[model samples]
Structure formats: C-alpha cells, structure tokens
Target: MMKYLRYALLAVAFLLCVTVALANRAPVTLALWPDTVTAFLGFGYAVTLPLFAIVGGAVGLGLVFGLVWEWLREHAQRAEAAKMRRELEQMRRAHPETAARGATQPPRDKVLAILDEADGSS
Candidate 1:
C-alpha cells in the first residue's frame, strides 16, 4: 500500500513537471552579472537555457546543498553513536556475568517468547 501510494505521488509530480515544462518552452538568458557589472569587471558569462531547466537545476542544487549541510551538522551525533557502540562492546567483553545474563534473558516480544517456549517443549 505504501509503495503504491509513493508511485502514485511520483506519477502526479512527473505529470505536473511535464505540464510546466511544456508551458514554459521559451529560452531564458541566465547571466552571472548585470551588463554594467560585466563592463566594469571585464569578465562575465551568460547562457541561454530553457526556463524549466533553470528552475530544475536550481532545485537540484538546493537539495544537494541541504543534504551536505545536514550531513555536516550531524557529524558530532554520528561520532557519539559510534563511541557509545564501542563502549558497549568493551563493557560486554569486560563483564562475563552481565553478558551471560543478557544471553539468558527470554525474547521480549510476546510472539517470539511463545515460539521459544513451544520449541523448548517439543
């Protein structure tokens, strides 16, 4: 059900994008700087692109930037999680009794516990 819904949403978005692209078929000039600025700087660039292409490119760049920003921001959390995991492994190794206790504990889920019991009795 979730997969179907995702596909439906994707199809709708694709149709909308196609409609927008068809409606905006004209070429648009994209400039790195204004004419006056270019004249003063002696260097500038411009390119003719479809309106939809320009819009899509901007959106794609924004998504890439956002992903990079988030990955950088979460670096500390990822490091902390790795540190804690290593600490847990060290503790498990250091305390044989605690590790045995954990291994002896029954499955927490009711269905798995019942299955274990059934297997033990068989």
Candidate 2:
C-alpha cells in the first residue's frame, strides 16, 4: 500500500512537471553577469534554455546542497555514536564471561541482587 501511494505521488509530480514544462515552453536566457559587468569583463557566458529547465536545475541544486548540509551537520553525532559502539565492544571483550552469562540468563531483579549480596557478605 505504501509503495503504491509513493508511486501515485511520483506520477502526480511527474505530470505536474510535464504540465509546467509544456506551459512554459518559452526560451529564457541565463546570463552569468549583468550587462555592465559583461561590458567591463569583455567576455561573459550565458545560455538559453527553457524556463522549466532553469527551475528544475535550481531545485535539483537546492536538494543536493541541502542533503550535503544535513550530512555535514550530523557528522559529530555520527562520530559520537561510533565512539560509543567501540567502547561497548571493548567492555564486552574485557568481560567476556559476564557478557556471555548476561546473554544466557534472565535479568536478575535489583531486590534479588541486593539480597544475594547481603547473604554472601554475611
């Protein structure tokens, strides 16, 4: 069901993009610099493309940058998680008997543990 819904959403979006492209078939010039700047530089670059192309390109660039920004922002969290995993592994290795016993046995109640400790001490 979720897969079908996702497909339907994608179909709708594709149709919308096609409609936008068809509706905006007019060619638009994209210039790298203003007329004054071009005149000063003596050489300027530009391209002519459909309005839809420009809009799509901008959206694609925005998505790419946003993803990269988010990944970079979470770098510290990822590093910390990796550090915790390494520390946990080290502890398990340092106490292999305890780790194996813990996995095989049901958890002991705190009260039971305290009573056992008192009995052992006495």
Candidate 3:
C-alpha cells in the first residue's frame, strides 16, 4: 500500500516536470525586457507565456509544502512517542508494587496473579 502511494507520487512529479518543459517550449515569451529607449526602457508590460507562470509556480510550491508537512508530521509523532514513554516511566515509579509485580511476570499472567493471591488468602 505504502509503496503504491510512493510510486503514484513519483509519477505525478514526473508528469509535472514534463508539463513544465512542454509549456516552456511552446515558443511564447514570458517577459520582454526592452533597452536603449528612455521612456520604454523603464516601463514594463505583463504578457502571457505559453502557459501561465502561475501553474508552474503552484506545482513547485505544492511539492515543497507537501515535503515540509510530511517532515513535521513524523517529527510530531516521534515527540509524542517520547512523551508517552516518559509518562509510563513516571507512572511505574509512582506505583512500586504494580511495577515490581509487572516486572516479575509477563503481562499475560495478570489474571493468574489475581487467582494466586485469592487462593493464598483462602
């Protein structure tokens, strides 16, 4: 499942690169810089490229945002795991008997421990 998602994302990236190349190759000028004319030199006009620069810029920005989001997610998960570990340790320290009994036996022996205690008392 994970591998398939990765392959899909890679395919999308490849397609995006292809699209950018094709769009840039469409033989349209995105920006025109004019020189040697005093009034025209300083003035600039916005013209259309073969495809909108907005599209290419959006794709690039999306990829960056996705990578950053994934990194932050994994970091947050790791921090949460460490916090839970610390809490468990503090809890064990506060309950000496529970900690000792838990250490001496496997977790599956919980019911057996209760039964043994009952039998001993009776």
| lDDT of every predicted structure (CA atoms) | 0.96, 0.97, 0.78
Identify the superior model by TM-score, candidate 2 or candidate 3.
2
After superposing candidate 3, which stretches have Cα over 4 Å from the reference? Answer: 1-20, 27-56, 66-82, 94-122
The clash numbers for all candidates, in the given order, read 0, 0, 0
Judging by TM-score, tell me the better candidate of 1 and 2: 1
Local error of candidate 2 at residue 92 (angstroms): 1.2
Model 2 global lDDT (CA atoms, 0 to 1): 0.97
* Per-residue lDDT of candidate 2, residues 1-122 (tens digit): 99999999999999998999999989999999998999999999999999999999999999999999999999999999999999999999999999998899988899999999999998
lDDT of 3: 0.78
Which candidate tops TM-score? 1
User: What digit string (tens of lDDT, one per residue) describes model 3 on residues 13-36?
Assistant: 989878767766554444545543
Misplaced by over 4 Å in model 2 are 105-122
lDDT of 1: 0.96
Model 2 lDDT at residue 45: 96
**For model 2, where is the 10-residue window of minimal lDDT?**
99-108
